[model samples]
Target: MAHEELNRQVRQDLRVTDRTSHRRLREQGSTSREDLDAVLRAGFVCHLGVIVDNAPMVVPTVYGVDFVSRTLYLHGSVASRSLVRAPESTVCVTVTHIDGLVLARSVFEHGVNYRSAMVYGVPRLLTHRTDRRGLLTGLRVLTEHCAPGQWEYARRPSAKELAATTVLALPLDEASVKLRSGPPDDGDGPDAQLGLWAGVLPLRTVWDDPEPDPALTAGVRVPPHVSGRGHRTAP
Candidate 1:
């Protein structure tokens, strides 16, 4: 009951509103906050859609999620034009995980099995004069988002490096998640009699054996978490 209550509360807290509302193909939409969280946690990279010079720009960058604050953090260069323009305007951040290829009898019916989330908000830029802790937290999330156990194993960033980086946090209050995963829709349709091949070919991202830095000292070995994901699909 406790878990149920928490889920209910999260749902209420993250209820989708206008603008973030799903329209066409509503069957592929999910209102569950848990689903949104899962999509965000599955990937570290996100395409940040913003307007620069009155033109649309979609910049691919690393991201981190602060579920506690209902925020998504984006990392970019301090001098990046898109990053500079983002804070001044409402930006859209999209994260997607492709699960498989959905092959159908008809080409028009073919699609991809994917989980995607789109979030819109005004971003908060973290700087030395602003929220330094937010930057640190964002970096931590970015590191852990890419691969768990890496943050602990890696060297910490220095002041100069932090100064060169920009962290932008966008609230997750307005977002939409759309996903599709299943056998092809044509499986039982008129095309079924065509006897064409139809099914899902799953795809996975995995960590291969670690390649040490060329400058590393001899005798070092791969860590457990690094090696444990052998042939294992990475989130």
Candidate 2:
């Protein structure tokens, strides 16, 4: 399906509850589902926050989104069930992209230009015995999201590998999206008379040239999908 049609299928608005309500900087908060989708689509990495052993734990992981289903697929660990052990537990997944540094004349006004999204839900774990298709689909979505066309170019997971892997699906129904961009907000404030330079220092991440392994076979060549990513900005 076309990207536009997929987006049309997504819920139009985000569900705002007490947890998602912005108490500060309400102007930065967003209720549009498209804003949330944009934040998620702009990055492949996310931080999964959940309670482990009665203690709060936050783990960094890669994620992919299924806009049609409004699902977020996350990579998990089979060894550490902190993510999937408790079937009834809720989790929070957050994805953020830092666009630049907002430099203001005053220290107190210094800020960051970023886009962030936080999703809260009870994750549904996909396992071989339970939902094999979902497991593979989630993994494929994750792999492609990180590196387009790599899933088909690389070896797929075997039955044994699939059994040892863990993947979670979380609904994007309840999420909070926030975006901060442009120049410093103190431009018209009292600090304007300070005569100090104030502007935004933009940041960008790009993919470098593909590095081949020392042990790579002599006949092997870098695929177009891999080599073409060189110098391209990352999502």
What does each candidate score in C-alpha RMSD? Answer: 2.7, 3.9
The local lDDT score (0 to 100) that residue 67 gets in candidate 2 is 81
Score candidate 1 by lDDT.
0.82
Pairs with backbone N, CA or C atoms under 3 Å apart (clashes), candidate 2: none
* 173-227: candidate 1 lDDT, tens digit per residue: 8888999989889876799999778899999898677778899789888888777
Which 10-residue window in model 1 sums to the lowest lDDT? 78-87
TM-score of 1: 0.89
* lDDT value, residue 194 of candidate 1: 92
Q: Which stretches of candidate 2 lie over 4 Å from their true place?
A: 1-11, 78-80
Deviation in angstroms for 3 in model 2?
Answer: 25
Local error of candidate 1 at residue 122 (angstroms): 0.5
TM-score of each: 0.89, 0.92
